[model samples]
Target: MRKSMPEQNTVPTSHEVGSFFRQSETSLFAIILICGGLLAGLAFLDSGQHGLSLVGLGVALGITFMGFQYGFASGWRRFLQIGDGSAVSLHFILAALCALVFIPVTASGLGPSGSLAPVSVSLFVGAFIFGVGMQLANGCGSGVLFSFGGGSGRMIVALPFFVMGSVIGSVILPTFLTFGSLDPIEIGASLDLSGKLGLNLLLLLGAAGLFFWLGRRQGFGLTKRMLGATILIAVLCWAVFMVSRHPWGVTFGFTLWGAKIANLIGLPIEQTTFWNWPGPQRALTHSVLSDTSSLMDFAMIVGAGLWASLSGAFGKADWPDGAQLFAAAIGGLLMGIGARLGFGCNIGAFLAGTASGSMHGWIWFVMAMAGSVLGIRLRARFGF
Candidate 1:
């Protein structure tokens, strides 16, 4: 989990933090840490168990993410480099399965909602930019969070800038909405649950078939590692949707974090057009602890870090060269801006949206893939 980087301060590195946490994880500290999150959430939020459930879900996601090392950026990179479609194919399957469950859940009116976003020029440009950034940073939204958990120095560097970019994006997003955007197009919205399920499944099958054909050379079979991880991760995601009444998401939490920080720094964020909206307005006024997505993000980082420590990922703490740090900064900034402009990263837009039967999810996937291709080429020029 440790990587080479240039030193800057006398402070103990995150590697040290990882090591300490790793050691503590086997002790009563682990239980306390988890309980702390649960208790805090329960106490702070009106949703009670539902909010605590999100905390638990976030920890589960972190553990699963690190354990399997399943990631969007790496998966796409491998597909582009070696023509392995296993990961790519598996994601589509995962989304399809989630859709099967989510469509019914939404219809049942149990409180769960889909990750729907408008179809706009911003969405197209943002997804593509996010793709490029993920490749440059070597992680997507989930990838960055878990990678940080696993004691990655480069990720630590990228994270703050990513936050900065998200804040900036949020400020500019309302303008993007003016650029030929269409209202969110929910697939089969007028249909019954059964109709939605069939239509969604049919569409998923078509997409999966296309992927399989395109990468048939290496085939689409997952390795034992990936298969096990996928099963566990998929189940966890389902549980999260059931409890949270929303599909899994990550980027919005970062954006919220940025927004909060901006408020602290005296930015007139609350007055901005985007923030003035009811949803953003509420978010701006609430504690981070009360926000489901933000809480999840926090838990995931802690979970990944403890896991990384156990894996001995913090044994070494080498600082990256200036060039590498510079690259990471640029990557983080782009990803942050892109995520906000695009409505989400892979997890939020592609996985959650598609699962919730939103057409924008499919659009995000196509554009992001194209962006990944460009990212790969840029990677060569940057000597990555």
Candidate 2:
């Protein structure tokens, strides 16, 4: 594994630009060609700029995520173990920044649709399970993507099962709906733009403040590098919404990927109520490149792969023991299933959900945090 650094958020005092380019020429060229070809192919299809633009944004996302080693799963674990809230505070900061833009832009009808979801029975149960799974697998949706991209053998094994779990969840999602759910509740649905923005800012900043207090021993501020990464992510995620007219999402793409594979294996996915929906049917018929989340997912992988090469950190992780492997498998399944039943993962339901003014986002955070506590307790049993 790559060696750990002493400090993650320190700002440099002077310009010390050493050799930053560590990636090989072959890798650099291959990524360029692949990106260029995808853009060109999109142009050939006469697809709008959204499809092609996502390819670039996706890469940028992967690079930032990998370069910073921003592990949502690990962040929670750190908080539980040592009361370190630096990472958790950073998360709140990111969400607040997004809310500053998202509330206004979406209110004006000039940007993407909100990442809303019903506050439901499934949401509660699903998010809790996902929390436990993320800890066991040691990755969330974005975590697994970059981890696998950086050549983690354990994550590679978990990836396929994640897809399988997504498909299974999708099949049962409608059934879960019948168990009773409330309509999605926006934080300030009745308020005007300025009013909602003010309220959301108050809440989000308050969250950041709470974490800051809990992590007092570690200090409340971010490293200079991490600060930059957080801003870049906020900008890139907003860009995704601007280009696609939909908020950033991760887990559903996994669901779609799984469904396609299931159909091939004679699962009769086409006969399912969820797949037969107009939107899903269109997505199923079209090539994966045409799916916004899928394209971004693929690009994130490439981006992470490129970062690993540049950082010279790829192929450093040793394979896991049998118990860890088993945990990864079960964890993958739980995350996939949780994302489907819960209506999103950390990225989808929590970050984007809160940013887009969905109240379910807060519900997700509470329940998942509880689940994480349990996951931590079970880690020893799993030989983690």
Candidate 3:
């Protein structure tokens, strides 16, 4: 006689989970595809800076989609059979890969950092503080956006406080600047790469090797359906990154949005340094950051999350108790203070810095990790 298998013992396949969301995510994906096609077509027709090669852009988007989901599963979601370290490990590798390629690109006058040399002190400090804040608030700027979009009540409160903190920090920036030396990192001047293209090619190879090794060691084990979800996220992130000409900075977008609404209502929102203070006298600080694409990107991310939640397919996360809220508010304020002092957030400083080969990014990571550990411990004390 054959042994009978128990129904409950069977694991739910990744395919099933993916199939459930196929209708929702796929429809959204189609919209994205259409919009991307239109944008590329226009860019091609105009022959301007905005007119990037559709094929190249598509490839980059594919890589990004794969990379983000891979990390998300391996790190945050812990979906893969790997431990917690897997996600962060991949992130650092990618960041380093980005820096290797980007440093040379910056040298060639084609990247974001104007003077790209070594990382600056401001960048490191900003990244460190931003990391701590992300852990405290339970998400990065981008994390918050998506979480909120997915119908997180706690994130609703958190997002507002974050904007308010940034605004206040911006207002007090002049006083802070008086105590600092604002200088650019002249990486182009200091770095001595023999050939930019050759270095970039090497970097690309290294990144490919890393992905293959990681995949082999810890297979996604996701069915084709689950893989589709991963792909969708990665593609979205890559497209946003390329179009912005900068790494994704979700917090800035939200902050800018808050400032815009306030200004529209005739509030003295612009009077605050947070919204309109100058940057090192080298740049004018106004509502220039309040743009269409960044804001739309932020909105869409949240919307996607919300759709996930409403369908009851997403996790049921909740708001923190009074103690947790206090910590979040304080953490948000500290993050704002740090971001102002350091000159960016996690996305702008840590991720961008690491990608650009700035030493500051490493320092920020160390400090932020310390902060996260402390915050998590504190949260645990409250029984959260």
For candidate 3, the per-residue lDDT at 340 reads: 55
**Full ranking by lDDT:** 2, 1, 3
lDDT of 2 by residue, 181-274 (tens): 9999999888888888888888888998888788886655568898789899999988988888878888888888998898788889989988
Alpha-carbon lDDT of model 3? 0.49
- 5, model 1: CA deviation in Å? 23
lDDT of 1: 0.81
Question: TM-scores of the models, in the given order?
Answer: 0.88, 0.89, 0.62
Per-residue lDDT for 1-384 in model 1, tens only?
A: 999798787755556655565565455346636755664555346567667777777888887898788799988888888887777877887898788778887888778877788999999999999999898888999999998776677788889989998988898999988888999999998988888889998988677666666677776555677767877888888898877778888988898999998889898888899899987789889877677778889888867766665665555434455566677788899999999899999999999888888888999998998999988888765567
The candidate scoring highest on TM-score is: 2
Better of 1 and 2 by TM-score: 2
CA deviation > 4 Å runs, candidate 1: 1-47, 316-319
Clashes of each: 10, 2, 12
Better of 1 and 2 by lDDT: 2
